[model samples]
Structures are given as C-alpha cells and as structure tokens.
Target chain A: MKYRGKVVVTLKSGVFDPQGVTIKNALHSLSFESVEEVKTGKFFEVLFDAENDAEAEKLLEAMCHQLLANPIIEDFDFSLEKVK
Target chain B: MKYRGKVVVTLKSGVFDPQGVTIKNALHSLSFESVEEVKTGKFFEVLFDAENDAEAEKLLEAMCHQLLANPIIEDFDFSLEKVK
Candidate 1:
C-alpha cells in the first residue's frame, strides 16, 4: 500500500520565532490593521509504500520524530491517508 | 470580534520541488526504502480582530491570495475561528 501523509511542525507556544514576528510586522504594514500576531510552521507531504495503515503510521511517526521535526522546541501533528 | 486563522500554502500538482526531492532522498537513505516523493509548504496562523467571521474570512482570503501564498504556482486554504 502507498501512504501519503501530511505533517505540520510548529514551534511550541512561548517559543519566540523571529521569522514569524517579522512576517507579523509585515502583515500589519499591509493594512491588516486588526492583525495581531502570527505563528508559522512547515507543512510537508510524504509519500511512501507501506504494508498498511498501521505500518504506514509507524513509519510516519518515526520520520517526524527522527528527521521531520525538531522535537526540542517544536510540536508535530500529522494525518495519514492511503494513496493508490 | 477577534479571529484566529490558519493557512496552508502548497505547490500545485505537477510542480517540481527540489527541496522536497532532496528531503525524499534523505528519507530514502534513512532506510525508508518505500519512500517515494515529498511535497512541502508553509503553514501560518494569523490572529486579528474583526467584526465577525465573514469579515475575518474576507481578510484571510485576501492575505492568502495576495501575500501569504504565491499565486503563480501555489494554492492556499485557511480556516477561521473566533478568539477571545
């Protein structure tokens, strides 16, 4: 079975992101007067051939925890879907 | 009303992403023999004060279409929620 998974890795709350802050300031300047703050993260879609949903999920979790996400200060969330 | 919106911007199908490909190669080297391809994007959460959900969505769309997403080759989607 082929597995297509989408993972989002974001900084934990209270972790200051200079890049996010910069974008927030830019948003404010763009006339989004009401815009207050912003949190930014990376979104990735990984496609792999797995045995099944359970096997795919195990690989997906390992991938995120090992390489896709920085476990020190970031939190990762993902969803698994079977792709042809 | 205050609004919190999350936006995801991803490359259109058929678009080639070298970064994503590199990541895919890395995954392959990590013993993910079944790994095939990867597509990556950006995720952003924007906070704003708006009159209501309708107004907030309008602004959110504008942001995604105008600034948050690269209209040339990327697609954006967002969800809005009320915040204190």
Candidate 2:
C-alpha cells in the first residue's frame, strides 16, 4: 500500500524560539499591537510505500525519531493515510 | 477576546524545494528506501486579542499576507479558535 504522512515538529517547551520572537517583533512594528505571541515549527509531507498500516506507523515513528526531530529539543507528531 | 491561530505555509506547486529533496535523500541513505517524495512547510501558532471573530479573521489574513508567507512562491492557510 501507499501512504501519505503529515508531520509537525515543534520545539519543546522552555526552548527559546528566536524566529517566533522576530516574527512577533515584526508584527508589532507593523502596528499589530494586539498580537501577544508567536511560535514557529516545521511541517512535512511524506509519500511512501508500506506493506500495511502497522508497518507504516512504525516506519513513520522511526523516521521522526531519527531525522524529523531533534530529541533533545523538539517533539514530533504525525498522521498517516492510505493513498491511491 | 483572545484567540489562538495555527498557520501553515507551503510552497506553491512547481516550486523547487531543496530542503525536502535533501531530507528525502537523507532518508534513502538511512535505508528508508520506500520513501518516494517529501515536501516541507512552515507552521506557526499565534496568540492574540481581537474584538470578535471577524476582526480576528481579518487580522490573521493580513498577517499572512504581510509577513507569514511569500505571496509569489508560497500559499498559507490557517485556523483560529477562541481561548480563555
């Protein structure tokens, strides 16, 4: 079977987000004073083949752990769906 | 009222994604050969105050247009929810 996955990787809480901070500053300068905070993360769409749902889930988890996220500072979650 | 927004920004179709290509190659090198393709994007969480739903939606749209995405090469979508 073929599957498509959507993964979101975010920095762990307590980690400083410089990019988010910069964005907030930019918004403030643009007169968006009501904006309070911003947090930024990464999104990935992966297409691949797998034998079944269980195998696909295992592979997805391994992929996220090994390459998609930094265990020390980031966390990742993903969803997978069968594709034609 | 306060709202929380989640925004996803992705490259428009036909745009070359060097990062995604790199990730796919890396996965292959790591023996995940079933991987066929990959695409990368940005995710953002924004917290802010707005008078109502309409005001929040308008602000979010402007934020995307003005800073969150590159109009020529990327497209953005978002969801907003009220928060205490």
Stretch of 10 with least lDDT, candidate 2 chain B: B4-13
Residue-by-residue lDDT tens digits, candidate 2, B1-84: 999999989999999999999999999998999999999999999999999999999999999999999999999989999998
Which stretch of 10 consecutive residues in model 1 chain B shows the poorest summed lDDT? Answer: B62-71
Model 1 ranges off by over 4 Å: none
Record all residue pairs in model 1 with backbone atoms less than 3 Å apart, i.e. clashing.
none
Q: Give the TM-score of each candidate.
A: 0.95, 0.96
lDDT tens readout by residue for model 1, B17-66: 99899988888888987988989999999989888778888999988876
lDDT for residue B44 in candidate 1, whole number 0-100: 97
lDDT against the true structure, each candidate: 0.89, 0.96
Report interface Cα RMSD per prediction.
Answer: 0.8, 0.7
Question: What CAPRI-style quality would you assign to candidate 1?
Answer: high
The sequence of per-residue lDDT tens digits that candidate 1 reaches over residues A1-84 is 888999989999989999888888888888887888889999999989888888999999999988899999999999999885
